[model samples]
Target: MSNSSIYTIQPIEFRLDLKDPFLFTAHHIDHFPAGNTQLGPTVPSTPEKPYQMYYGDVVPGFPEHPHTGFETITLVESGFVDHFDSLGNSGRYAQGDVQWLSTGNGVEHCEMFPLVHQDKENPFELFQIWFNSSPEEKKQDADYKMMWREQIPHVLQTDSNGHQADIRVVSGSFLNTDALSRPPHSWAAAKENRVNIYMIRLEPHAELTIPATTATSTRFAYFYNGPLLYIDGQEIPFKHLVELKPDTEIHLKNSDQVASIMWLEGEPIGAPVAMRGPFVLNSTEELNVAFARYRQTHFGPWPWPTPAPVFPREQERFASYQKGVDVEYPERM
Candidate 1:
């Protein structure tokens, strides 16, 4: 068998449609002139703001939308996300906080980037990963939870050379560290499934080994930042997605000053997936039903006062669910 564990390393293509209102800005300090302008006419474009804005006449981010049949794990690396849903769920959280939304049956939601830093430029970055569920779990009720920054397990591993790697265990187990917790209906809930989500940052010239999966599973490593890195002696380019083989440890070496990567691994569901805008199901018939129900209900009406909502600048990280569940976290670091 080949010694290489990587299956594929594909670069993500994000061509910004200027009018789309979504901007992908990373690596640079975005400075906005002090004013009331939501988005300046001559805003500098980075990899982050590819689309510029999406229905963000007031703020920048996705507007009201609907989803079903899947879950969204939004890990915020920098900046805060204001969330509202048809089920009366709402939250305002920032850095290192995670929003795990299980939109099992159906739910309407809105994710807007409220400009909390109006006095200066509003800079932010995050990742929203979608996890599929079994056919039986698709018909369950909708729910969500927030993983606060302090609750997430952060471990630092140092090599013999004194270089260190900061590892954030978002889900699953790594080394001796475990994640905060996952939703009951999540695919990562079962230990036998061997699902893992980790964010690793390597100091220059650092070397680290990512543990292997127990059974046959799929693992994806997203090289989002840092200089070129060597994985098992193979060079990994920037902004690439590397798919690795199951049951093999990943030896990574940072060739340059510093590097960071996001790792996602789990057992493949091995089931058919029919996906449409904001929906995923097993068949076209189910997709059609989701659309029909969304049209009929409008997701129980938008409860928030505005399509793009923002909390007061002094507000802390918090989550409030439909069934009177509420959670508030300390200020984000």
Candidate 2:
């Protein structure tokens, strides 16, 4: 591994509004490109829109669009993603259900709120992670996979200090409920694979420190529930995702209140990135190809065998939002 330049949790300045009206009328303050304007236009683009665990919607039919070259893992923590695809698989992927869709070789999928959830009011939470696959893996298959909370290993552990965490293995080890400090003990192998993830709960004004390691890997953390901080000498503003350099230990404390954090870190996938409306690729040319394919015809050798229900409201709302909207693409790549 190579040493990475140090970085700080530049405060999350960008807020996006949900353009798709049929979807939840919400704002993703961190990275959603269309997060509400009320949060303002200053939301800077960092590593990108991180994985957001969205709950049930005020409406349905979100982010109504197509995708490919990525696998969206929607693990339903509470409600469901009543989804449909060009493959003709249409049904509700409900609470405790996990929806893993590989948009390889191109595929168009839509997520709509279930009729059952309409006004019924259900709490739904899901982690939508954008996992990158090698170009070869991207063309291997287009498919949908689902698993229940029971099927996946959900492990729990508590320390004598009254700190407990529930672990869910999602790609990487997913641990939640409590944050762990520098291990009293250490290991070589575990440290080598250092891409560990955790959801930590912090007590008011509680402080902790993350020790530096030898391997030149970067560490990123997101504070969601509280104003927990990855300190910067002075009180630097906090963000959902904070990036740090290797050998850079972190000092953290609740911002005078209880806090929660989602911490993720891994070696960077140093690839040229190109992204446009649900598609992320290495180059704009690839994106253009994807857009051409998406516009001409739904991607994949097989399109939906039958007609999927049209979310008219979602369509109209997305259209309206698309109007007077300028997608700010990354300038560097």
Candidate 3:
């Protein structure tokens, strides 16, 4: 729908087309069956089926891959993810966790979704967003950081009708709650950038108001889950994205069923973007240079034994940074 408050409404596919300052976003929801000895689904995923094994056959995920000139923000809503990168960082993070990786010049990373459970179904859901980096920031060294579920901020609000709205602040401030710190070289590092990513859930028949930001910022609301939703009293269907006016307050009213929405807003980078495969750069010439560099260095050699490494079945949520001390979280019940 086109209006003064909304620019466009588009149906969401596997990969979402985002605007400046944001390159790409995809929502992955896979209902994997029991795992075999290889930690992959007992029933292999086919192209026409609901389950997708993307790049890995033994393990259902992308293997060692290169990325440049962008940052990956992975939010795991349901299941766990095993992350291995060339910088010698590894981690196993689960539901409610967020992994922010700045690829800087270049980095090779493996994201394997291990079906930890062997006896029952293993359902996994995650949202991965590719945020653009400035020309200068793209040349810095790679960095990886994890925001555990405990460290991230979650806020709850209830309207006069007592219907509640649950808000998870992933990259920006919501109400009085602030998100965890981002990588130093991230485009979101600057407060003036006004980069914000929020995951909001509304109870049945709930009403919530999204506060306004600067007019210069770009804003979008994606109605990903649940039934009907009303934005500023306008009906919004499921699996649809609306480009919102950043300077105006927006009201969201959910139907009788619970609803989930992903809200992304940020000031435009206003830089020329040239993308080729996994490389994002300013010009085509720069992308060519990135490709040549990756071929020459292989993004600093993969230290892990296999491109897709499956951690022990009993391993809990933990992070082993390249330089920092390794840390482990309490085992989930």
Candidate 4:
């Protein structure tokens, strides 16, 4: 079937295996020089926060983990994720709730679900966005906020074929309305990297279209539930982001079933982005500071690292226990 995206890929004509294409699995620990970081007889405190996150081919459950520098945007499509951080805040958002966690300076938090309850016939799906907080906000008090399904404003977008689109702005916009913009900061008005996040629903064989965003932006498109035959002039490798030329309108379709796609675009913050294990920093010095703090149990909210879990200290003992799944050790001679 010929489908059209915002803009067509010109039918460049590439062979694709929409049913099951090859994918490179991701990592809980994204280290430099690629591959896993060296581990000691016992993992350092930072790595043992007692959490398990689902990576490609990994069992899903989380004792939990820590993060800093960026905001985590979570949108639930089916199941739910209960989050508890050092701030003593706990909430389980499911089926149509969105949660945003901004860990600016630093924070020790964990994300996990006690069980996966099935949704009326659909499964669970979500998009976790990591946005860089302005360098200053990073060190401020940690914050947790959840917008319920009803709280999310709904607007109908229609394509030429009576396909009605339902959209929710987790943060950013729909025309003149800024329903989910950030909580006010210089970055909000500075106008550097414009990051817009949206939750969209498409009907069977339906088409959702959008105007061209820009040339220098990066778009992370994922189909958490259902399948998408994203049409760019040509047929793209199905189920994968068919990168289009800049200023190209986007046309997407739900062919296999009622598909759902999360679209997030932003200007590259262009900061020194460095991450290792649980810390993300701009310099080796900052990384060292994070390491020492975990080693000394000194890092906490408001000064350098933001406080994430109010009860992290209680889990200190289990923090040393690691099931140690398939750690992708670096391939070296």
TM-score of each: 0.88, 0.58, 0.96, 0.65
- Alpha-carbon deviation at 8 in model 1, angstroms: 1.3
* Candidates ranked by lDDT: 3, 1, 4, 2
Error of 2 at 42 (Å): 34
Model 4, C-alpha of 58: deviation from truth (Å) = 17
Give residue 191's lDDT in candidate 4 (0 to 100): 36
Could you give the C-alpha RMSD of every candidate to the true structure, in order shown? Answer: 5.1, 13.3, 1.9, 13.0
Q: How much is 276 displaced in model 1, in angstroms? A: 0.8
Return the lDDT, model 1, position 263.
78
Candidate 4 residue lDDT tens string, 1-333: 344233222221222211001111121221111112111012222342332334311213343456665566666665445565655455555667777776665566655532332222113445554555555665665566666676677667777777667777666565655555454432332335556567777777677765566677655454444644555534344335433433567766667466665555655555675667656566788778867766666244322132221222112111111122212111110
Q: Please write out the lDDT profile of model 2 over residues 143-245, one tens digit for every residue.
A: 6655444455544545445544344443334423222221111110133445444445566565655556435454655555555453544343444455555
lDDT per residue for candidate 3 within 103-218, as digits (tens), equals 99999999999999999988899999999999999999999999998888889999999999999999878878888899999999887898989999999999999999999898
- How would the candidate models be sorted by TM-score, starting from the highest? 3, 1, 4, 2
User: What are the per-residue Cα lDDT tens digits for candidate 1 across 1-333?
Assistant: 244687776677432111001112122122222214343223545665432455666666677888898888887877767888888888888877888888889887888765566566555677777778778778888879888887888889999899999999988889888887788887777887777888899999999999888556777777778869888988888877777776888898997688989877887677788878679888999998888998898757788787777666666778887634655555543
What candidate 1 gets wrong by more than 4 Å, as runs, is 1-3, 15-51, 323-325, 331-333
lDDT, candidate 3, at 31: 87
10 residues in a row with least lDDT, candidate 2: 16-25
- Model 1, poorest ten-residue lDDT window? 16-25
Best by lDDT: 3
lDDT of each: 0.74, 0.46, 0.90, 0.49
Worst 10 residues of 3 by lDDT: 324-333
TM-score of 1: 0.88
Candidate 4 versus the native: TM-score?
A: 0.65
lDDT of 1 at 145: 85
